[model samples]
Target: MQATRVLLELAGNVVLLLWGLHMVQSGLTRALGGDLRRILGAGLRNRWTAFLSGMGITMLLQSSTATGLMATGFTANGLVSLMPALAVMLGANVGSTLIVQVLAFDVTHVAPVLLLGGFLAFRRGGRTRSRDLGRVAIGLGLMLLSLHLLVATIAPAENAPMLRRMLGMLTADPVVAVLLAAILSWAAHSSVAAILLIASLAGGGVIGPEAAVAMVAGANLGSAINPIVEGPGGDGHNPAARRLPVGNLVNRIAGCLIVLPLLGPITAGLQTLSPDATRLAANFHLAFNLAMAALFIGPLPWFARVLTRLFPERVAVADPGMPLYLDRSALRVPHLAIANAAREALRMADAVDSMLRGALDVLHSDDRKRVQEIRRMDDVLDRLHDAIKHYLTQINVEDLDERDARRVSDVLTFTINLEHVGDIVDRNLMEAASKKIRRKLRFSTEGAAEIAGMLERLSETQRLAAAVFVSGDIRSARALMREKEVIRDLETSATEAHFARLRAGRTESVETSALHLDILRDLRRINAHLVAAAYPVLDQSGELLPSRLKHGATHG
Candidate 1:
């Protein structure tokens, strides 16, 4: 009964530690997720810089898993090269150890202070970021408190012969010890928590230093496994998505292979450096990662080449309708989720652009096959729109700050407008082209040029819409709105010119006058939909007028 009670208490304390670590990771991710992504995106210029970036981000995030996810997303999207991303994994491993190093110290006295301060700030802080930072403080306090509790609970169990014998069995085989730690770390999905648990057990004299060191190695190996297993597979065909995580796992395994044989000497060296079992465990964790970083950092470029060959990018023969960047795993991180949605939305815009260009070809060539292709393109747009919409809805509302919420709305609106553009091209514009082809009608040379001009202008606006969607640049948004007016003026002028050609009694204009007017109006409508992407951005910046009408003037 006493052993069971002690075991339950130990489990509870471990749960508290894991919860505290979660708060730290989620809090920091919510507060600085975008800036951290930008930092990683900008700093991954080379292996060395990528290493630093990875370390810094993981230090803030407190979980190497989060860092691995971010790095994987980058490489999968082709935003960064594999060599730099691999370096980031190395740095992230080292960063996770730093957290353990801090926790390994006897800072139980500071726990109460952190808890009190965090509670007040979290409940009273005015800004969201402030509240998020407060949450980080609270997590730190809980982690410290749990460690204190964990040590107290283990103190009584150290004298238990059953516990000692159980631990002794594992100590008999270093490989088994390492595997046990790896499984614990993998199951927890957090090496920091696993190592902290190992550290607590060591410090409490319930486990020997040799056993602790072996567990640390196992824990490190286990931590890398979650990312590979849980990461987005890019619809299960893109092997490039696995390269970064695989490279990280390989690095951990190599380090473990090197250290496992030297466990006796390494444990002795660690003990000489620190007699405290907790400190010894923390130091070993740090030393193992640093050694891995040094060993793998130089061969990264060459290693990248090897991985690329192994996972060779298969030619993407997949369906165009599938969502490519809406990574389901990203829904836990609001900023990353929004970015993924935005990327998917861009794919929608690209499909719409294709439809617009195809509509122009159908107008001139009257090719039945091109018209069918344009209709299929609209179907692709619809699928992409639905995928983005559902993906954004999956992101937890509470996880999103005001800024991220606005971004979600913007991505949805952009994709919605592009879908409308696709509809115009397929239903209205293409139908007009079909009528001309069926009736064997041709416009006057002047009318054909006018129609071509309108299509060209709408396409240009669409290109700008994609830019505005990504950057949300006020200047570009304003330019997109201005293009709306340009397209409208061109439509009005072309309508009048077509009528003038009719008045001149041109037979071709008379035969195709109605189709000419329909084509012009549909092109103008498509431009309106394209420029709608700018309104949200302009409204958010307070640059857009609520009403274009003159100050409450009455309409007759």
Candidate 2:
């Protein structure tokens, strides 16, 4: 009965620890919102900045895996370069050591105070900042409290014959102990959890400093698995997608090779400096990570080069069915996922613009070959549109902050407009192509030149609009809105002129005149959607409402 009660208590403590950690992570993510991404992005401009950003983010969130995953996403999306990401990962290793340092201190007397303060803040505070603070406090308290309970429960058990025998078995084979620690850390998806378990065992004298040190080394290696598991998996052929797992595995393996041999000397040195066994173990873990980081920092550029060589960039087959940027593995970090979604949306916009350009080319030239090519490209654009919409829907299910929610909505809206733009181009240009092929309809030289000039303007505007959206340039975005007025006036004048030619019998056939009118309508529609794609950027830059663009007024 006593043993059963102890087991139950241990189980409860474990549950509390997991729950507290979850609350803390969620609260911090919500409180930081887009600021987290902006800070990390800005700080990654230089090596030192990247290192500091990585350390700061990991320490605040209490998870190196989270920090590494975000950096991987940034690297994959072309937001941050490879060297900066490596720098951040190195910094994350250093920051994680801080957790072990905190655990090493005897804070049992202060645990209850933190717990009380956290509970009070959670119950009485209304703001996001206050609630997030409460979560942080409660999480720290629970971590410390759980550690206290773990020590009490296991310390007495250390004297039992069965427990002693188990300890002897682990210590008897240090390789097996290291493997066991690696598996445990991987299973938990948390190095801190694994380290804390080792610390508890060591504090109870069930595991000696040597065995504990081996486990610590293994824990560092094991923690890399989380990033691998969270990387792009559905289509493994992508070079960037494949690099996620490869880079994580290589870094961890290299770290293990450098650290394992030094463990004995490091632990012994720590023992000599700090007689307290628990503090000694904690210091050893910190020293190992820091030393490993220093050793690898110089070689990281070579490592990245090796990765690039091993995974040479392959020309991806154009499959409309395949998504260009939407990878579910990104959902693990919501901000990065949103960023990926935005990138995919930009690609979708580009596809639509390309289709519109193709359509305009066919309509002006009446070329059968160009018509067929445009139809093929439109089919591709349609496939990409469906993929992006489905991807965004999946992302919407995860918990998102207000800013991310708004961004998702904006992406969805932009995708819809882009799809409509593609449809307009396809229907109008294809119809014109059919008439020209069947009847050999020909326009006057002046009429052909006028339409070609209009097509050029449309093509230029589409290209600029795509650039503005992708670059997130408010100046270019607002300029796109302004250009819409010009496109509208040109479209109206061109259509009226074509109609005048038809009424005066200057054009060849009535069908040709109808096709010309439809082509003008399609150009106008494409421009409107391009303006729509730029709306979010203008809004983000604190510009006027989209209604102003539609109404051609500054109605602020």
What are the runs in model 2 whose C-alpha is more than 4 Å off? 1-12, 22-53, 73-84, 108-172, 205-209, 232-234, 238-251, 254-277, 298-309, 315-329, 393-399, 443-499, 506-509, 534-556
Candidate 2: 10-residue stretch with minimal lDDT: 547-556
Number of the predicted model whose lDDT against the real structure is largest? 1
Tens-digit lDDT track for model 2 on 1-556? Answer: 5445555665576666565565566667767746776788888887688888988888877888778777777777677677778888878878888977887687877889988998888788887568667867887888888888877877676456566666668765667777888887888777877787787778778778888878887888888776666566435546665564566567667766765677678677878988666776678778877876687678777877777788766676666546656767667566667777777777776676666667656756668877777777667767877777777677644356556677778777877777777777677767677777778887656566666776778777877877875687766777777778888888777777777777878746354676667767777777787777677777776666646743433233
User: For model 1, what is the C-alpha lDDT against the true structure?
Assistant: 0.86
Candidate 2: Cα lDDT at 148 = 84
TM-score, cand. 1 vs. native: 0.88
Native-to-model Cα distance after best TM-score fit, residue 330 in candidate 1, in Å:
4.4
**Residue 75 in model 1: shift from native, Å?**
3.5
Lowest lDDT sum, 10 consecutive residues, model 1, at 547-556
